[model samples]
Target: MALQIGAISQKGGVGKSSIARLIAREYAVAGWDVKIADLDIAQATSTNWKQRREQNGIQPEIAVEPFRTVTQALKHASVYDLVVFDGKPHSNRETLEIAQACNLVVLPTGLSLDDLMPSVLLAHELVEAKIDKAKIVFALCRVGDRDNEIDEAREYVRKAGYQILAGSIPEKTAYRRASDVGKAMTEISFLSLRQRAEEVAQSVIDRLSKEG
Candidate 1:
């Protein structure tokens, strides 16, 4: 069976789809057959991004498909080495469902309490629903370049009693431009930006390794 990973969020614009594409690209580059289950039916962000990627003739050829339910997406698990579930923008009943189904549930958020509070709340909700807390992880996204702010945010998540990934997706126009052209975060033109994004991707990979 394929290892299922979920990129979930409490709201939009928090880099949920970005993380999903990042994981898909990373595994595909490593020669693993990967597919992104774009569960955001209303936006279809990842599905459209895949179209743009094909237009640009990107390598490795990551696959993406839209599905209305997590159950529907899981049916394709046997076809790929990995299945990334890109959940919708807001928290709902499906949030718990995704958390329950995925081997790892990643919640991406910004560095502010407005983002962190709700993310932590969502994690708590999953735990209350009898989901394993160990399976839930946090990733910082759209973060500013302030070391103090980043450290504080990390501390906040730790205080909330959950593990946060090592690397973060910084707020940069270059990243947005790369995504606009159907490129993953690690595909940015700027070497520094690409490396930083790779670090975030590697952190996810390492977390999955430990899960085994």
Candidate 2:
């Protein structure tokens, strides 16, 4: 059975691509075949990264196939254990469509108020589309480990009566460079980020497993 996951957000530049690739890496490391739908054709961040990873021939065994169409991508999701969709960051009709297709849809957000507000709105859209609220998880991205920003963001989400995933991704230069090189955090040298990423990945796995 395939596990389809989509990483989407209403606002851009909140590390949506990073989370998509990270979960792909984690699944691949666990010996599961994974692919990315990669709907953000304009940025093509995940597609470009996929090409680079294929070129470099990294370990942990993964495959990525980029698709521009939602129907085609949804069809492809039937094949792999995991199909991660990196969605366009904004209010997009396709984002709603993607949410409806996957078993679990993750919305990656930062600690800022601006990032939080739109993400909540997108979550609302997902729920209104009749997507199960349990299928949606909030991924806190680019947060400092010790900084108050992460807790603040979590508190805000909680106060708004939304449940967020227990994991948070730290702001790291290594993560940035890894994405630039078309690699996931686990593929990079920084063991700490990789560990954190594993925890994040586990949280995501828990959510998907619970749904299943």
Candidate 3:
């Protein structure tokens, strides 16, 4: 069976899809069969990105497909090394089902009360539904230059009793531009930005590996 990793959040613009893409790309580059199950049928962000990636003739192709149901998506599990689910914006039956199915669930959020509060609430809901807390982790995304803000956000996560990633995705325009060309920072020409993106991707891999 393929290892399933899901990026989920109840709020929009939290960088859930971006994180999913980063992790999927990392595994793909490392020679693992990686596929992204784009569950947001309305947006289909990852599906579109995958199309763009192929059009550009990018190497190490990452397969992405849209599915109306989680069950339908799981049918391809036997063929891939990893299946990353880029979830929708709101909590629903699909969201809960993904939580139950994922080996690791990532909840991405910005460093602010508006972002943190709702995300924490959603995490709590997952636990209430009997999802393992160890498998659910919060990823700080689109962070800015304010060190204090990041520090405080980590404190909030700790106090709320949830796991958080050690690396974060900074708010960089490079990230947005890279996606335009069906590229992640790892493929970008800028060495510094590429390293930044790798930090978060590697951190996730390291953490999940230990789960074995």
Considering lDDT, which of the candidate structures 2 and 3 is the better prediction for this target? 3
After the best TM-score superposition of candidate 2, give how far the Cα of residue 5 lies from its true spot, in angstroms: 0.5
Which lDDT tens digits does candidate 3 get at residues 150-173?
999999998999989887788888
RMSD of every candidate to native, in Å, equals 0.8, 1.6, 1.0
Q: Candidate 1 on 1-212: residue-level lDDT in tens?
A: 99999999979999999999999999999999999999998999999999999998888899999999888998877999999999997657888888988999999999999999999999998999999999999999999989999999999999999998888989999988888888999998899989988998899999999768
Which whole-number lDDT from 0 to 100 does residue 115 have in model 1? 95
Root-mean-square deviation of candidate 1 = 0.8
Clash totals for all models, in order?
Answer: 0, 0, 0
Task: Return whichever of 2 and 3 wins on TM-score.
Answer: 3
Give the local distance difference test score of model 3: 0.90
Off by over 4 Å in 2: none
lDDT of model 1, residue 127: 92
* Regions of candidate 3 where Cα sits further than 4 Å from its true position: none
lDDT of 2 at 159: 77
**Cα error, candidate 2, residue 135 (Å):** 0.9
lDDT computed for candidate 1:
0.92
Model 2 residue 11 lDDT? 80
Best by lDDT: 1
Clashing pairs in 3: none
Which of 1 and 3 is ahead in TM-score?
1
